[model samples]
Target chain A: MLPVIEAGTGPFTQPPTINPAVTADWLVAFLQDEMRARRSVAKAVIGLSGGVDSAVTAFLCARALGPENVHAIRMPYKHSSPASLADAQLVTDALGIHQHTVEITGAVDGYLQLEPEADARRRGNVMARVRMVVLFDQSAKYAALPVGTGNKTERLLGYFTWHADDTPPINPIGDLYKSQVWELARYLGVPRELIEKAPSADLEADQTDESDLGITYARADAILSHMLEGYSNEQLAERGFTEHDVRLVRRRLDGTHWKRHLPTTAMLTNTAINEFYLRPVDF
Target chain B: MEPPVNLDHRAAPLRVAIVQSKPRKGRYEENLRELGEVFAQLTAAQPAPDLVILPEAALTGYFLEGAVYELALDARRFAADLARTWHEAAGGATVDIACGFFENAGGTYYNSAVYVEVEHGKHCVRHVHRKMFLPTYGVFDEERFLSRGRRLQTFETRFGTMALLICEDVWHAIMPTIAAVKGARVLIVPSAAPGRGIEEDDELGSIARWREILHATAAEHGVYLLYAGLAGFEGGKGMTGSSRVVGPRGRTIVQAPALGAHIVRATLDMREIDLARATLPLLGDLGAVLPDLLLDEELPLPRGLHASGH
Candidate 1:
């Protein structure tokens, strides 16, 4: 959901991704040093979503750490789109990485049976969490760490299930928005079908992110960014958005603020974790 | 050691390699491979050249019309790749490379020369000279596609102080003059000029005109001039390949035969620039004649030069 500047020359405006030269150098340096120092391993494991986000992440990982040092895992449920599996295989084959297809049908269904009255959203969350379990297990066996595929637009919108897609040791694509992901996907040489496919959580049949959100990511990202810059509710409506939609988004923004932060503890001690203890993500 | 263009050893001498290449019109990747092969050959030579010059639009051929922009190079990624190829082929030898291509700059297409220097597998683009004079008559319609360059400046490289100008930029004396004034010891023209007219010597029209300008510029400025020309036939436009290196005394050191691929090399004496200027004092007196100072004050034209404004 980022504004595409200078877009007419190609499908993308300017690629929102980092410059190829700078990115290649930094990522390679970062991955090699961090793997040796922090993880004591030389490999990375990534769950492949049939989406641009994961493909791009995997592509960079392959470049930073050689394809031999990267493992691609595809965890699909019975209801997962067949195209997603094909796309995951496409990336793994292209990068020549070690590939594993772990079907989470049994694990997801086992959790779903305990709460048979759960809606599609609740069941989808279970499937996502189950896939994470499979990914982490593969990571440990391969002496690698799972790579996060969730992007900024999804994170900003609270589109991902907590502790599922969000829980990863490394996430290079998280800071990029959905629209920016398309630009990077093109630059990274990800499959066109994967980039162009309608983005979906694949929780239920015929469920698209835009259709569920009731707003296009293109418009929503622009508004969200403007809002974050302290655009008033009136200003946002003036720009574009019905009063109703603005109210819905504003309320969601207020409601989801907690999701963006680490869990807060009761301030019963001399110092809070927020104030005293701070740990930066590495490795 | 320089890159592949040494005749003999001399103190502070600059060895220049001029590669006259024929680009497969609109094929950027193929041209790069060909350049890689040339670089491989150069790497094997004793006393490798200090500077390697490739023809104008060597990355993508000139006269591409509408598709030139589409073929306009992405210098960053392209340079990184070409640098790796050079390092691998050259066995990690460092060389300053000046070559031409259509550049995509701020959504505008520019006929440009990208000067790259690679050392130990790392590369840096030293200068990007967008074409200043875009011809728009006869077989030339560059202005239709290319955005004109705003500056005519020179840069310092590992070898020596140098300046790069695209094909038509050399046609206008002021462009080369500006570069000479900017402390450039070597004036480089990466050209895509086509051969014209039939002569007993095969050097006539465009080739002859180019030689005249190159010699005059080099002799006057006391600077070595390298003209790297494109040699190819694309859609009936035959590019003239009279790529040559002219000394400060207006002497032609080595020139590629017209309309053919060649690798011309010559060793330049840096002290000769001082010798020539000291003997002639023309470049020395350049400050009194014209110092590139701008004056907005309007002066009435001389009688015979123009019609009376009144």
Candidate 2:
């Protein structure tokens, strides 16, 4: 089935999500601010999943602070392969950050339904939220901040669960697209193999971002850039874009627009109807 | 090993006097006069004190002006005179006096204590200890005027192997631990602590309550911990007079009435220390786990003399 987009629908007309390039000196600074802004933040907490995002965020925090300041928690569910766990250990040992492991299979199974289960999306949200809860628990114990891992592409399409990826005090790569993250990772001296690995949510078996999205990251970046630059939908389609793809992208651009803003507040007084605007500092 | 000191095997309760009062600020003469009255009161009692403990900086209140001008002690002469007066009042009776005073020795001023024995209207001052730990935070400015003490002395008296420490001396783990390890049955602490700055939520009601936790240190280390603190306001600051007595088992056996200039006493058994240490052997485990910075031969001084700043 093909998705459709109505005319005059897109996130461009609304308020922007966080743009790290404008507000932050670097990705590390952004992440640090996020972590320390919370009352419960002790220090920086990382989960070295042997994935590029986690590894990159961990390294950035470690550099911004010190190796001692960065604490890592590795949570491996039942189906997590031995290789992934080994890779996680390798990354943590290499980074020299404090690390602890929690095998979560028993907990996960105890909660599983005996009947037919929910879809992958719901299950993924559950896993993400579970991991977040664990991160928060560990963070409280050490007085550390949980570092989140959700890139720009996932954020734009609302691919992440609201409370899961957003659970961290700091998100180092939240502003950069998947491809730009790749570029930054190379610049940051990340191991080439980890960076080259196909981007996966690792929530389900054999799930890859490119395969699920039905488009390459390079193509998605070009389209996003064009959309962000105020290029019309007609212009995007004219620039070697498919009819169904353009409509699908535009529908996504409209449907997830609410993710880009603070929730609505009711106007209560005179000059209060479109009169009260919140200051950034107040929030 | 045979018992080292000759003490009464049959325990006799002795009156313990704690001069829980601060010295008058910058008025050494007035403070000495006030101390004279306290001494007179203690001596006039039906059963006079077997021992009297005075607070750290008892003669000269927490002196701040000395650090600025480099003249800390004008009270040593006054302290000597006061000692003579107290000796005369005691009427040739041997009274073990832990008198805290500002000691000016070899052109260096120190916050010190003197254990004097009053005999025949003359004084025989024997054991002397300067404060080892000099606090440099909050309200305290000990390091500004006074130099750190290099010794932890345990004096043999008519009582027992009575170990002595000044205010901040008891805060460090090793100081009291070493004193206990060296077979001190009684730990005497003379403190000049000001108690006015306690906030509403400050965990303990007063700083004295926090200091009282030293009872646990005494219990764990198997020693009797006694605190004698200043009571009145001095230099516009409220001095804490919550003096206390703890047994070898870390229990508050007796606590003096809070914020008052008074004397209190308790009967202690020296044998209880060995019994407690035998039951709960925490000190042995701590000894094995902790590195002895004082015992490092590569370092400058010998074991007891090495603790300069804590």
Candidate 3:
């Protein structure tokens, strides 16, 4: 079986080595290759939530696409903490990328007036989707791709909003863990204060990811790594994870499996759109 | 309603029966006896079937990977014998026989399907298709003993252009599509699908999805689909045996009961396929609308990217 990405014929003739470690130079070359092929000016549009993951993703996109091509947007609602705005601007200033601040409090309020029966959870999701709407609007204006900031931890747990904070043209940070994101962020010169701040969804006051998941990032990462490595249930239990914890993670993984899928449609032909087993990529 | 006329172009509907049978505990003779009994019962009916299909690995149960070398035989002998006997029983009814066989040639074993046709005092195997796609994941270990077939072939049967596929071969989307594209009116799939757990849904969504995918493939390529699966316990694993026949409209026209060994028959209207394809125009429009990632003979990794609606 052949590999997914075909090698290029250029001064850099050798194919890039794929591994767990991601390098700044490799990202630059990959972006250059995709941009040249697409024949569009490379640019990044980020939804800056003042979270470490977004901060790290924005910085990486800036380096690859150039700070001039990188654009950051801060979408704040009425309930958003002032510190989130300050931290978002701070990171943008440090990276020297053009920044835009969009207040979505009115948008949310106007939407609610039309449909006030919207519950809290629905309201929060609407805000995230609205923020993405604005970012994608910027993408159209600049012919840029909306760069995703979701980390591996968030993805595994299905923490990010679908088609909102999660949807992007490219996802450089998606494969990295939350713990690993901090390491890469520090390496890429992200502001230490932003990196050090406790992560929050900022949908409601003091709502941390750990609160909803019922486990800290440290514990979630360890169990997730074990699962990814195909460790048996007995092996995980012997290694100190309780059955409840393991089952919870498994159930969460299964429940959120749809997040990893495209919308299911009825297949009416021999070649199904969802039949990925016969995929050409060498595995 | 206008006065009806029998058009010469209107071919008679072919009666195809998928014998979803339970093979006796590695006892090849007993399994053959069970099949003979079922065939007798099916053919004795008022409107007898034109063709009968058995599951892949039907002669021998879903034996473990190592069991293939231990149990596989020169299937040509058994298939030839069965065809001769069945044709004699049909009393010149001209029934075609298709069944799973263990093909051993030059000391290499293959899980294969053999189609035997006995015409005018001459008995011969019409087509032999080696199971091409082998399942290596989870409970399946087909790749261990069977050599993967390199080509997809079709035969012009009395019914229509018939394509033969053993279990995993249907899982290979490209091969089946290619076979259908090459003018196979009815695609026959012989499978040994493991039975669903007690807690599982009665309909078995996965099996239904498999049917949907196969039916869609058939509809897209203007063909009918016949799937015959094993039933009851085979080796330590339970065989589901919910084999079905899906028409071009993506509906299950005939399906065997959940766990029993039985033969289900359905009349296939092959002519409707050309009309369906003509009306829908999916096949003609497909090449113009497929995504760039999906244009080549290989599937794309569906990484949640936009399809871009090509």
Per-prediction DockQ comes to 0.00, 0.01, 0.01
For B22-69, candidate 2 gives per-residue lDDT tens digits of: 556566667777777777777776567777777776756664546423
List residue ranges in candidate 1 displaced over 4 A. Answer: A1-283, B1-11, B199-202, B291-296, B299-310
Q: Candidate 3 lDDT, tens digit per residue, B259-288?
A: 767778776655656655665666657545
Pairs that collide in candidate 3 are A268-B216, A269-B216, A269-B217, A270-B217
Report the error of model 1 at residue B231, Å: 0.2
TM-score of chain B of each: 0.89, 0.80, 0.84
Clashing pairs in 1: B2-B48, B2-B49, B3-B48, B3-B49, B4-B48, B4-B49
TM-score of 3: 0.47
Candidates ranked by lDDT: 1, 3, 2
Residue B240 displacement (Å), model 1: 1.0
True contacts kept of each: 0.00, 0.00, 0.00
* Estimated TM-score for each candidate: 0.48, 0.46, 0.47
In terms of lDDT, which candidate is stronger, 1 or 3? 1
**Residue B78 C-alpha lDDT in model 3:** 65
Which pairs clash in model 2? Answer: A34-A169, A35-A169, A42-A143, A42-A144, A43-A144, A43-A145, B21-B231
- In candidate 2 the C-alpha lDDT for residue B297 amounts to 78
Q: What are the lDDT scores of the predictions, listed in order? A: 0.77, 0.68, 0.73
